[model samples]
Target: MKAWQITTPESGLRLAELPDPELRGGGATLDVLAVQIPAYTADLVAGGRGGFPLPIVLGAAGIGRVTATADDVFGVRQGDIAVATGLFRSGRAAEPEEALLGWTGIGGDGRPTPTTDRMRDVWRDGLCAERALQPERTLLALPGAETYKATEQLAFLPWLGIAGAGIERAEVRAGQTVAIVGATGQLGSAAVLVALARGAAAVVAIGRNRDALDALAGLDPRVIPVALTGDRGVDGPAILAAAGPVDAVIDTLGAAPTPEPTMSAYQAIRTDGRWVLVGGVRQDLPIPYGDFMHRRLTLRGSWMCSDSTILDLWSMVRTGVLDLSLLDIQIVGLDDPAAALTAASHRHGLEIVVLMP
Candidate 1:
């Protein structure tokens, strides 16, 4: 099978022909269809994100057709379409460990531990290949995806599902306004659509990019674009003016330069509203103890989604509620990493780059 690999950070990312994986006790082999490469994939390969096992196949989450599953893998069988999410958990009840199967994500602290190291050793090869081997826990079966024509668009499922998980954590609902910070990015853009699909009366798409905001507003009349100027005082008021008393705020800002963009949107949350953090904002959020206690506000930190979240989002795509046709996707082959990596770096909302392996 041909797959992208990085023996070391100094070696960089490359395509290589590798031996087929042996079927293990809990592993499943897949014929990869389309795999969505996120904007920061280049960074991940350059060792900017974090450490992973050396001599590893480099790819994150994607959709694939199950060619075979271990006998113990009963949730899905052969000839099924499986959603291979990169996220994998240790299944421990107390402070369990987690690792992004073929990528840089380690535990919640973003630090690599002995446990996470062992986890990665077991499942280091990623989905950026003609075929892949994944643990059953990281695979979710999609019943009708076999006949789904738009495989490139369907590659965006991982992002959409993650965004939907954060939205669900915020308890977004009909007749309520929701605010999505960094709404111009891939995950944030997905959250905007999920909020709309869940029947939010209005969605405040807050971001620094004006053109992307305009694109989001064009998706629906209820989408109110708020361009951030960085000043929390001014931006907060602008967000509120656009969408009154936001019932929930999902912040998906990645590696933020400052927390102001997020805090500004935070100010618009309703008195009893919820705030969900799913992005890579590194700054410490200074929440006033008095105000938080007085307002009865809630805060949740959501990572990759649950099985139910992806299933629900898949249903929406199948039913045409969350339209895939609106997306602008660029599909590429497995041969070139330099061009594809550069293409993936331009963080345009709803503009995707996929690998058709």
Candidate 2:
């Protein structure tokens, strides 16, 4: 099997032929159909900040078909289609340095377990590989849903959880407005879809990409575009006024740490409304308490969500509410994972996927 390995933090990837992963005594093996790269997550792990086993196969999400399984497993079956994310609970024997690979889950005690921390490992073995040794519990059975485009589903799965989970935290209501900053980015784009599906009366999409925002106008006329750049100023009240009242703000970009538009969203969100941020913006920085307090606003953070949340997102995909076809998803091969990472790092394009060769 040809696997893409990130041997060092600074060095690029190398596609090398390695022995195929062996099945655990109790788990199942899957022949991967597609592997989606959560490029941003991969970059974070490769940078060594994500606290995962290094040089591991780097992927966080993808879809595949089960090829073989242990007799005791009943959650998933041979030839059944599934989407795997987070981490594998039990599988391949761990190497000295690879013990941290399958730990991406949040444990019962509320601590981030192996499954939560090692997202890159989860992506690589669970989602990106042509053949995967997946614990039955780690794979979600996906029934045939014509609404789900396989390629698009692979690209959007991880981010859908990120965004959909944020919406769930916000508890948005119908006849209410939601603002999505960096609305054209992968996570932000997914948030837009989820917000509409949840019945947000209006979606105020804010971003620097005119083309991307313009493209969204045709897909769903409810998205109101607000173009914001650092050099030029944005009037928060006016933008929200134009969108008519803002009830919730979904910020995928952090203005204090990375960009300035996030600050605008803070000011625009109605008092007592919610602002759910998933992007790495403004984590440690001091927020304006006066503004936050005046509105009695709820500031919340969202993680990848529990397994049940991912299943709920899959349910949305199974139904017609969340549209994957409009997203910018491109599937690539294993030999060239860097290009996808580059695009995601620079925010130059949409979802970049590296599928099994």
Candidate 3:
């Protein structure tokens, strides 16, 4: 089987021919058709900033067809199309050769066991190969969707998680105004869609790139694209003021100092409004507790959603509420995951790329 392998953090990944995995007693194997790349996340893994294991197949999401199955209870069957999410049992837990192997959960009998963890790892491995062994937990049968690309459909994993977390943290409700900082990246753009889908009255898309901002304008008349000409820290307050008093703020810019957006979040947001931090902005900076206390603002953080949240996202996709086609996506081959990762790290492109098997 042809796959990408990250030999070491410093050495990086390469396309190699590896052994194909076999179906376990209670597992299934999918013939991978497509894989998507969140270039930004991939770069982090290559640089060792992201915590993926070495020698692991590099992918976050994908689509495949089940070719074989050892268990009928898993809801996936041979010849069924499926989409995979990679957030479960990651790192040492998801390593195929590791004890956990990505499957970790309690049994139906209400007893905790290692069986669950191993099953999850098998699911993660299935995403990056021509043929893959997928656990029941990670595979979702796509009964109706017609086309699948590594970059486009694969985006459901990261972007969907971002949108879910941002909306939850912001406590978005109908008629509320929401602002998405860095609203052009994989997570940021998804934030905009989530805001719209959830019925936010106004969604402000803020970014440093004019082209990206312009790109999002057509997606919705409600999306107001604001540009950051200067540093975010230097220009954040003014930008927020221009956008008006938003009820919620979704900050996805993962940078140091985080700009002074907290001030914008404080001044523009309603007294009870929340500020959701999805990126690593100002991670090292101290928060102004005085201002936070005075404004009575809510500050929250969001990581990838729980396993169930991911499943809900799939349902959203099914309903056609989350339009992933609006996202920038490029498809590549499995052997070329490195190039996609390199581009994502630098925030180089307006689109996300998916690696196909």
The clash count of every prediction, one per candidate, is: 0, 13, 18
lDDT of 1 by residue, 247-318 (tens): 999999989877788789777888999999999888999888998888899999998888899999999999
Candidate 3 lDDT over residue span 1-357, tens digit each? 987765666666677788897888756777777665554555355462324334566555567778888855467778887765544432344432222222122223323346444434344343555777766655667665445432256445545665677787678888888988778766787788778877888888877777778887778888887776545455566556655778888887745354554344445676777888777564444567887688788888775555555566666766777666666666667656567667555542246666666
User: Where in model 2 is the C-alpha error above 4 Å?
Assistant: 39-42, 45-51, 87-126, 145-154, 231-235, 254-259, 343-356
Candidate 2 vs candidate 3: the TM-score winner is: 2
State every prediction's TM-score relative to the real structure: 0.97, 0.81, 0.79
Per-residue lDDT of 256-355 in model 2, one digit per residue for the tens?
3444567677667777889887765734534788867888989887756556777777777777667676556565676666665664555422445546
Q: Best candidate per TM-score, number?
A: 1
Task: Select the stronger candidate by lDDT from 1 and 2.
Answer: 1
RMSD (CA, Å), each prediction: 1.2, 5.1, 5.9
- Which 10 consecutive residues of model 3 have the lowest summed lDDT? 98-107
**lDDT ranking of the models:** 1, 2, 3
